[model samples]
Target chain A: MDLATSGGEPERFGPTIGTLGEDALVSGVIDRYPSAPWLTVGPGDDAAVLDLTGSLAGPLIACTDTIVEGQDFLRHWSTARDIGIKVAAQNFADVAAMGGRPHTLLVSLTTPADVPAGWANSLADGLAAECSRAGAVVAGGDVSSGAEIAVTGTALGTLAVPRAVLRSGARPGDLIAVTPGSGRSAAGWALLRAGLRDVEDPVLAALVREHRAPVPPYPAGVEAALAGASAMIDTSDGLVRDALRVARASGAVLDLDPDALRPSADLLRAASVLGSAAGSEPEPDPRDWVLTGGEDHALLACFPPSAVVPAAFGVIGRVRSGEPGVWLGGRPFTGEGGWRHWS
Target chain B: MDLATSGGEPERFGPTIGTLGEDALVSGVIDRYPSAPWLTVGPGDDAAVLDLTGSLAGPLIACTDTIVEGQDFLRHWSTARDIGIKVAAQNFADVAAMGGRPHTLLVSLTTPADVPAGWANSLADGLAAECSRAGAVVAGGDVSSGAEIAVTGTALGTLAVPRAVLRSGARPGDLIAVTPGSGRSAAGWALLRAGLRDVEDPVLAALVREHRAPVPPYPAGVEAALAGASAMIDTSDGLVRDALRVARASGAVLDLDPDALRPSADLLRAASVLGSAAGSEPEPDPRDWVLTGGEDHALLACFPPSAVVPAAFGVIGRVRSGEPGVWLGGRPFTGEGGWRHWS
Candidate 1:
């Protein structure tokens, strides 16, 4: 349990977090990020004071999420750095979904005493890198001991426009569009579960990487908003589930065209290899993954029929006057395939 | 494992969290609080939008903290309601320390799948009650399944004045004062650890209750700010430890007078009972708890010597030019009795 050493060989061994105590552990995590001008009072205080006097034109948008061990992730499946990147991406996507730009993040981490100090350092690096990519800063955070590793992140953002693109704004004639690269994360998770480690196939390897670290379309949300999107949401739960959410919130029916959702080249290639690897089981459907896979973090928006859709977005469905539900190929699609924390 | 039952008998049994699913569990938790006008978009969306236009005169102050089971509290020692109240009080105190008025809270809970549904409901009720007590509202939160119960709270507040009271603002010849009641929480924790539970002594019982639920003077923070307090911090990490923080940050020496910290009546009574219950061991010093016991969340502030100390605050120490550290009775106090997360 005493995994302490002087050298920087984190892969082999490092000092356990308990040996260094709370103050040193905190300094190690915070030293990775540079100070920004917006932070009036940074991490080493009771609370962080932010100066947003003229930075925002409208109200502030806030969101919080927690990822727990054994429930949301497994250590053997992803590195500590990957966990950090994934959490930042998850929270930033919420701000993007509201057509706002993320400004600061407040992170709370709970870990076992025996965890290696290198794990926390790598996590801080990952968080700093991802926040830089999203144009935000890690303003403050708290660390404590716990039974397992659990991270809860809160993202704060500013709305530069007059109004935010809410989910309840879709109209009957709006065209439903989604960002490209849907179902890659789900396909990646499926490949990992199918015992495809260190995959020789390029497509399968890419899928696995997508599963480990998803690069959400952060800028596409603001672009869609400027392009006059009536409603907007991120595909964190699945294309079907998220679309249904907008439909129910707007009191309209979303009809998907089957031909529009043809599997991408990478998905098809991965599916072929997975089918060949499986001797007896049926081949997994790539189309089904595209329809129901979660954690893609793609932007899904409703644009007017007369409006020109952004080049980054593709039209996949249309809103119509009907009961609040999702329909595919003029038929109601009944499927229960989405992320559920308790189940 | 299936502890489900109808009627209002949460104490007896109830359905596990897994059986109800995520949406239902979230609904069960959120239905406890009433809606407020400041919450433009509440819990059901991707993020909670708050309209702060014309609500404050200065920038925002934000803070977050997490409480984990087995690390911060034990189930047998404190009820779920106590846990909820303690978390809220702790977060609110941080905002108050900055001389800010807390406006809203965002809570995230991670619990085991086998946890009873009633526990979540009661926790929500406790959080609502305490938030109401502090003149704040629960705008949003996230709930997920984990190995143990962990709560992370984010509190957002606004500085009504032009500037905030910072820890680095204390100068030489300033007066160090603290809100009334400091050692009761620590004394209560000691009594609990000493197996003095269910005591016939009313003073000891009140001490135990204080340990479970600390009522910080929230309004006094703003009063101190309006009265031109130069430096301020909350006593979350013992009086001596927090005093050292201000000293180090301000580059000055803080000297405490032993006579000024006279033991409260409840502390004296609790110490007497603990000593009698010690059997053959030496009696623990109540002064140690007063100096090194944390979690009291008492506001510690520095004001100019010429300024009138608020009637609610008690003067205990003074600032002077010397090496940066805490001094007691004109001598440097050397004690290693503060809470450490990973030790």
Candidate 2:
């Protein structure tokens, strides 16, 4: 995982949250996050107050996402800090996809009484580190007891442009492109599920870390919006599934090019190792990972052919007026879709 | 409980959420909320977009609160709808305490697979009902799977005046007051705990209902702020405990008059019933419920001597310059405190 190093290692040896009352736990952890200038009244009060008067003119974007232990992450595969970072990243990506600048986040963590008090502090560090990276601050939050650990983040952001880049804005003759960094998390998930956390290959070990925490290209989203991009979405789901969402929303077809994908050779090597580990199985294709893997949080947007795409984004396909669906290599790409809760 | 009868009873006999899947479950429930004019982009998007541009010119207020099953409420005492309303009310009260008008709420719900598909719809109905009452809308939210049901809501609001009423703004000569509705929920909690759900006493039964769902005096908060109130807080905890918060935050003493409190006669009846049920020789004092019982969610504010306090608020005490603490009838009121998460 991409952990923060500047704060020094957290003093993990401490009392459990059950012993330290809620007020003490909150006071100890709230200071971990740096306050934004916009915050007038912060933690220790009933609510937080932010001055966003002249900075934002139009719609303020808001979204909430929750990560539950055992379902979203396993204790064996991730630490409390890792869980905090992952939750913040996933929630922030939604605001970024809307072509907005993230401002503040409200995080609520519910855990069992048996959890260590220091776990909350480390989680706050991870949350603060990610929020700092995304140009936001942890404004306020709530904590309560639950059967397991569940972290919920509500992200609020301001628009950089007049209107948000929505899924339905894509039109025919638009170029379908994605910001760099996709499909690595799915590969890491596969390796971890296969009991290969300590992979011998250095590249594969990095993939395992990437799976624990995937970084999204946050700045490219606003740049694309500023450059007159049409439709946009974060690839939290697999490429084809999210592409299909744009296609269906816009009533257009997303025709992807296989040659433009440039699937990673390292992923291909990992695929071979995974296939052999399962035994007597057909070798999986790295292209499948590039096309169908989820949680990479890469920005996928459609721009007019004449619009100047950001240098960091790679052209992957073109939008067409046809049956609303995703097309791969001039064929109807029907494959297993991305992650869904309780499926 | 203050149940909404406008919408017909929620259709509870339906498929379980596990069988229906998250996408279907969300789509089926999202429509239950009423759309606000400020909502430019609501649910079914990357994030909700709210147009709070010209209307709110000053600092915006935000707060989050979560409710978990078994800890906050019992399924036998509360329906899915009651849980939704109670959670929304509690979160909204925080914004109200800040002298702000609640505008939007982003809610996240984590539930187990065995939860009924219709349970979410009923929960949404309750959320919408409470949001309507508070003049706020359910902007957006997320649903995920976990071991138990937990609802977390982040409430965002706009200040009614140029400045927010903070806990530390109280002056020594301020008048301490509360909006109607205090000690009822505590009485209700006592009745429910004593296995008096089917109590023949109508007054006690109402308390039971009030415990399951509380209706806070939300509008009184903004009125207090607009009327130049010094400081404010919501009585989510017991009266004495929340009073202590204002006293400590302001570094002033709050001397309360027991006669002005007008402790509820219904609660006195509840205490006797509870005492007999427990086979206690001495009946529990109802005054203790008024002093230490929590979850009433009344607005407690301190106004300057010359400020025109809102008519709905009942003067209960006066602030004095002395040791920072709360006093009852001219004596230090050292009693059991309010709710704590891990305690």
Candidate 3:
């Protein structure tokens, strides 16, 4: 929730957005993203111009995601900077899931008129930082007034390989793999929701931060694609639910190993701190977080039996011919809790 | 505000979005934009795949616009179908303003959980209809839960010529031209605001419809570019305000001719009907709507002295070497009303 660390020194609270007006606020936000060469024409024009001539091959991959105020994050729990970082990470992760590298982002931000101008600037800073980390630029965006804050990001990416890795391409007998760690975000969310935010354990605090701003492994996706990934997707809706998406799409059941779903030492330590903070209740199962915690933005991929899974990705399961669903330890696991916007 | 007439017969009211869940709602919206050959990997994938190889010539033009509930449109004033049409037209107009041919749109929609599922389907129908008219496709979209309806549309367009027509390209000697009609939308908005929806005159009702759904001249943009337009912009933020943007960007004064500013007979007739419906209050000035009304999405361009203006566009003004601002009848005109989201 600390926004000041991510960008320049936070300004003393300035004018309300209403006083500054849309044009001035827009100019301030646009100033945050400095001119880049790939952005042939930046924010001043009706539309931003992007030069994808030598950069793209085969086809362009596009995806969009909208994070709303009460649904996605509570303002009291998250700073504008955290919102910006999470929005960029989730949208860019979709491009990565498609075996493509994100090159441009178009952001549509809606906020109440009473929001401070400084908050908008800090949000832009966070977006710029994340886009910079992903090797992409903020091409253009639209800002409008609404009752609560909502950020909708559309990301465009280009594939280095000829074909994109799709969720429906996983064949039977393929190895299912995922980015090194998962479930930290869900554990963090549990801690925060349980009013353990001020817990003395640094590990627990780190987990909370992870929930606020996910760090998706951007490069590993391209490596997996190059390694002949049969199918891929971002773990935005938890490991099991997203895996079910691939299972249904590919008509293959994914059987995940129970041992593989056990929480890592760091996660277990964080869970213990949260457990102790809650007094008499039994310690929450870290395995549940690992299996069903969403918003990690971790890349989950499947590779053919003959293909070498990327070093950064840990093999967690295998695809097999069966009724289309996800299984754990040879049994159908249906403890449902993944991020669903409507429900 | 009637949504039923724009597309196929409206389906009976369905279950609320909360009962259907995110995936089902997404599937319903996706079904509206059927599979197209150019969409290599469509709605079900992590990202939509667009084959832009043979379709694009130069750089791609991208623009995003978000229309919120109260700020952009009121549900009682505009139906779901009208919201969809307005979103598409406003976004596509940005591409046209850049002298590019819009090819694809990615929509991000957020609505309350209790919204009827039928409303979403109708909204998608309106989006599809407009995109079809503009020679574009609805490649993909994201739907989420929020307190109010907000549609964020990102449009991608391809330039036929090597360079895009920027607002800064106009010279002092250029002629300012606009698409055949202007201020109809504003006049329509006035009529609606004054409770003249049930007016006896059909022309007045049509104006109300125009306020709900604007039909921007899409093809004229490319024609203007091909005919060597110096600069171009869509009149989304009123003629005077948008013209001031061009004037500031191009560093030239745009001087309007008073005769050209007169409202067409069609607009005047509608205004008179609305005035009569209001009972004894002074009639709103049609000229004021022509100058300050926004959301028309009409293309406004500047052409060089020798360049022939497109037949669809009417000459309205001339660019001159002076201060960076808009002028009406050889004098700086500054009347306050224009769309400002934050205000």
Candidate 4:
């Protein structure tokens, strides 16, 4: 399917995702993905430029994220479409984490030849689908034959006006707010790990989708930065862990309100069956899961109490200048809420 | 240790790699590999831009390549550093293939955390080292933990006063000139596969290095475009196979002069020593290795007879408006030196 003229007279193969050339693949995907005005050059150029939307007027905030099969994602649970969106979402999430809106993207893939044509084109489809979903364009990419499937993307974003709400911006009086309930990924993982057969819960299913692809609340990122968010972080690592990065960088004390965070304790609903089977409620603490679950990708921002917090943002705690670290009560949140690269 | 400020850190691990968060990593790499004056917002932004050298600006060329474990390389034979340099080289070579000078690069790595600190940093060092060698900078990258190590890079390039010499531009009557020989990678693979240890020949060692980390002639790419070359290609595949790409794209007949390519036959000296022991000068032809051996990454171009061909570009044949395919000795060259992912 050559968007430019049907890829040299399309010879069957049921609407070929694209002709078998790297350039053709790029053209196919780029045709599907919308072009953003900030892109000075799109897919054909060596590189692309996104007008600087840095917190400061001139500097642009940039980030890249590469997803590898069997490493960042598993083939069994996610579709090629999921990966396409996930790759874009993850990278753009980084730009958002820095308080910038993602503008342009460059993608590249390495795969074995035996791999079906659609698998790659579908990845392109996923990339285009997600880029369109988020208002960005696919700029350029490379294609090569390799062992396993690997996808890498570089993202460029503009800060419209540079006032980056960095991790270091949190202050003593800042009120810590989480945009949504967490532990969805952790709860989802429990369902997956238990190999729950005959599962029927809708929320459990939603949690599973969240684990496979963490659709970041991007508007919230932009809103948080614009609304005087002192510091912000994406809940990539466990909430406490990712939050601690902001806390550590900000040199502020983070105090959680367990009472206010009760909604985040929905882990047991999904894990209830497993907990019941274990005959001990699995000691499921939705708080623990919310604090510990990695990949929730929710936006956590610190703001002054007077700041107009959005209705969507769930107020979790307050900040005070003190020793760096995160707390559940007086003690630090421990274990799974933090990332362990190896150990 | 930073090249700018090497030894001021606290704990001594391997190198200060994987030490920074994504933002700091770019800042750190850019801290070392600073951009030129034309660079507007080098590493901190979403994307980078360089001033075009002249009004006769060559079109921007882009390409991507990904390398993965158990597929592209044997970790035992090559270090992470070797892989890093090679990956950058492979992608940058494509820009060179387009008859453009590589200008900037973006890298993405999916690394397993357990992979030692030394290994990861060495990869960064190798990237910095090789990009310097190519006069390019590592602009930005993405990092994620994966099951297998995968690195993908997008290389951006500048076209000087001359227009780009594309593979599709080949016309009938253009003389075919290959910069160098092939079969080096085939030879290198044989050596590594057979566990023949290291051959004493410096050229053979270089051949192994070529297979491991190829340095494409960047100048030659620029030269071909400037020299009025009708079409150009990089010899990632063997000579005959890439010539066909030019053939198919330009819809012109690519004819090779076997006698003109005699200089390339010198590559068989070492192969003959091993081949004789295996009985009788290898298979159909030992020259086939040099003629068809892919991965030598030599540049090949078809220049107009009146076109000023450089001494560096070895003239092997000419192009004719005949059958849309490559020829040797006035007959169809059946050798498939082209790379196939599965063989």
Candidate 5:
């Protein structure tokens, strides 16, 4: 767990920071990423190309996101490698949310003079590994200098079939289903922010790992699509918040049964550790954490009442005609809280 | 040309910078950069899709580039808006270099807090306008807060035919021809540093504009592809510098005819400007500037001598089977300087 080398001093890699030159980092990253059949031409070429042999009229869904040091991530808590994986993971989740498969990714990075060389190299490695996990490639990217470290990733995806299952497709009489519950990452964040270590709880450690490197329900999203889900979205910003995005975009009122989430609720020990860290601030309800905390990257979808809901996911709500809002127990879900960048 | 109103103070704008939120900037940018026809479902959907009706084996070429303050750009000469244009423009050039039709772009940005609210909006304005110029659309992007300004743009292009022209495609029999010389941006960089304000000097002004936003020869690349160009590349890091890339990749040497550069050699004002900048730095040959000073964005290609060099361009060099290098007038081009990101 200790990166501190055996040397008396911190192990000094090449150029002390983003200094060995950006192209070095780029070439190094590409060297680790490698190329495959889908990649007609790889790095060193003018552009990275993927041979689209299977689908021509395939829907190309693109999504992008950035990770900024001190904002999107903390250098002390998450390594640059973790940041890169999260950036790709979160964006690819957007593609998965829409029932699409990630095909390629383009990343651009800006770093300061004080950042670690390992940061850039490991970050790219993370991206390459995650891209392969999502059945895609880290196609091409650029690197430049800045006052702080920032990693930006853009994902290109393809919906092999024609149907998109957009956010605007949810309708009344559709069963509000979700692939998994939430609040693990939020609890993990709470523990991390509180400086608590050696929690000794496996599930809590797993939850913390999820927060650091989220394993998105990639195939399960397509599973939901194939199972005839009408509309789908990933709970990136928590159940209630992301659910609202679908409701607003789909123009349908969503109603959820709070008691229905008993099984999916996150009850790990990290929750207690995080709950105590609220510091006598009259902590918010843990259910609200499940309802609104994001970054877990679970999928939420709407299907007909008789549709087959998978074993991993469950039904906790329904789509209805009313004001474009989410309701709990037929009443308004009063709390409004979710993740925001640079907060 | 004046953005200010009649009053001494700058005119106020609606939704004063304070009123617009982060989401507003995102929504504003998306609203301005409307989807292109190829984009099936653009931004706002879970993802953006490009409806690819082209052949199945079509190649998807993607590239990402980042621009950072004090590194890739200087705000003293360019605004955040101009930087946005530059960021988008530079990435588009990569697609052009691939001989692919630029179709869509994804942008990711991080900025400082002291920046004006309208800073990002104006940047978005420039991005939208520039994307239009490139026949592309801003599909999606992300934003976060940071200590300095940084913009990352990812471009996606599709080749008309299934194959892609690679830097590794040249042979000894190919005739070396350049559509035009590049170095205009290098010249402009020198002029801007010297504080040259002569807007009427069309060449100088064009040089400055080209430096700030080098127009990638998008169509000419396609033309070269169709014209049976043996190998091609965009003169980004200077002519000789990039030519060496082709030389190294294609396993062939390049030889340039000094007299073939009549178009740029005849530059009455460019010569004058270069003469002044040399100033006891050793009056280096103009060929060094034309061959090694970069940022011109000119198209360079190799073809058979019998192949017609279009009127827009002329024969500037020839291919040979010597050491992997470039030659000017039968002698190896000795210019070694090329722009490097973070030495």
Candidate 6:
């Protein structure tokens, strides 16, 4: 239904959650989820059942992420569907980062009573759609009324490889590489913060959409692991900050190349638009977004020099023996980096 | 470490979440979680790994439940520890309702930045305590800043029996029974609402404690399933409303015996306190509380006439093949029953 753009639909303003009641509202959303072979029992029961009767090769991977209104996103900038998509993407990306295949998710939402039932339904639809895209299914969830809106998802995955990837596996002399996308979500956030919306330029509009909802490189994670990547993490908190995490965990120094980390052309153009909004000032450096912006959920991994780096990955740095830290162009780069909650 | 009564502890007023930062706050809580053999990977990684290496039993059971600050509880009434215990108990009860043994859980908490860090630590401790009680472990979770406090838990359980006892399996000749607890939580809520706190009466004070955190009979679920229960559900929404659900799902009529459904002595005493608070009403019928009170999380199951009901269960009703509804005292019982969200 393209709920992100269907702001003018009449039914979008239908009965409120209070008027519709919890059961009917839950039933409407649960019906939208497509059934899967692995789901032995669906949402109507006390608990959803997953058919894990056969012996598993490896361990089961699980991760959870949450998004709250006015904290992670602004209500006017991100629609209900955008919120749903972004929350699902972040959690699934975590499983993917572990060299696992996501199979199921349980999402819960707490909203105010005045919220329209259709908005909640759209959120579920968006969540379900993304699950299907990732070859996973929505197994079950809970809904309740609260003072503010908050959505959480716990994603479960099965490891395809015998051993799951760990961030502490990066060793000295390993090469650091990242999947194609990075910094677009940060650029989108900049545009939104600058009071720019409904931008006419396709590049600018796309950036705005990315800010609202990001498409993480889900498949690249498994591909990297198959290709023998040493350590892995999803770039939820910019390249430098997240890379610093791997470096600290592995007790090695990560030396990043400046030329290889240049901002994308779209980000450069976005900086231009944001710069003009403030009169008589030079363009804000797009490199900040490239090096420090987060939420792209790109797979940042360390690979052995002897292993075949996946085709989708771009080699951007190398691991060296030293005190654990991150360096740019052979020097320590001290710039404000990525998002942190309650900091 | 009894957080509910340890309000005067100096550490309880320690640094706020904003000052502590997300990583430190998360680490403090994660450190409290005891590791287990089944947990292949713990909380520090991008995802947790559960060692489901060999599986020959039934499917995996999953369920999620959420509790909000103002909707389900008030901050003044429920301490952070009480809130944590209640939330964990509710999710585990759902798993138990499916006749599964809970093994792991992922809890997510969203709260304002100004909250005391100790409050969050206490919450995690409480959750871990309850998980231990249920023979489970806290595998992973997420923490974020938000406008208000909301906690959600996704519990994972493994079935012990070959088949799950569903709510739709009741036959015409089945006997209805419930575990040895009900109406305590509702009675507790009434005491709290009447501005009664720290009562001299030990019995009344216990009811207040129950409202804050009611314990569910976790073992009885598996006991019912093992004893060949035909239909089962947790009484999260009063006895009659939940029994009605079982009846509607099984396409049968549930005839409840009111004589057997009498309120416990604690409830009768609580009603006397509430009736006195009104100053006029003659001890408002404790029978209403027995029939309509909710949140005790007692397991209600239908058994065959010959099935040896578990020793812990009290027989309260029978099933008959007629219109799908609930009857009491040989007539159609039509009194208002149970709790419903956003009604």
lDDT of 6 by residue, A1-343 (tens): 3343555433358899889988788889899899988888888778888985443335788998998888887777877777888888899999999998888989999888888898888788778878988888999999888878899999998887878888889988898999876888888888887777667899988988877878887898889889998999999989898998898888999999998999888988999878888652467788888888889889999999999999889999899989899999888878877889976
Better of 1 and 3 by TM-score: 3
Off by over 4 Å in 6: A1-4, A7-11, A53-57, A278-282, B1-4, B7-11, B54-58, B277-282
Worst 10 residues of 1 chain A by lDDT: A1-10
TM-score of 1: 0.93
Q: Candidate 6 has which clashing residue pairs, if any?
A: none
Residues B78-143 of candidate 4: C-alpha lDDT, one tens digit per residue? 666667778888777777776677766777777655555555556777777788888887766656
- Of 2 and 4, the candidate ahead on TM-score is 2
Candidate order, DockQ descending: 3, 2, 6, 1, 5, 4
The DockQ assigned to candidate 1 is 0.77
Q: Which digits, one per residue and each the tens of the lDDT, describe model 4 over residues A52-155?
A: 22232343455566766765676555666667888888777777766677766778777655555556666777788777766777877766665567788776
Question: Mind listing the fnat for each candidate?
Answer: 0.85, 0.92, 0.92, 0.30, 0.83, 0.91
Every model's TM-score on chain B: 0.94, 0.93, 0.95, 0.84, 0.87, 0.94
Best by TM-score: 3
Report residue A288 deviation for candidate 3 (angstroms).
1.3
TM-score of 4: 0.78
Error of 2 at A141 (Å): 0.7
**lDDT agreement of model 3 with the native:** 0.86
* Candidate 2 vs 4: which has more DockQ: 2
Candidate 2's DockQ: 0.83
Chain A vs native chain A, TM-score per candidate: 0.93, 0.93, 0.95, 0.84, 0.90, 0.95
State the lDDT of candidate 1 residue by residue for B86-134, as single tens digits. Answer: 8889999999999998888899999888888888887787788788888
Report how far off residue B179 is in candidate 6 (Å): 0.7
* lDDT tens digits, residue span A31-69, model 2: 887998888887878999988756754568899999999
- Rate residue B34 of model 5 by lDDT: 68
Runs in model 5 lying further than 4 Å from the true structure: A4-12, A15-19, A55-57, A197-199, A262-268, A275-285, B1-19, B54-57, B79-81, B261-288
lDDT head-to-head 2 vs 4, winner: 2
Candidate 3 ranges beyond 4 A from true positions: A1-12, A198-200, A278-282, B1-12, B198-200, B278-281
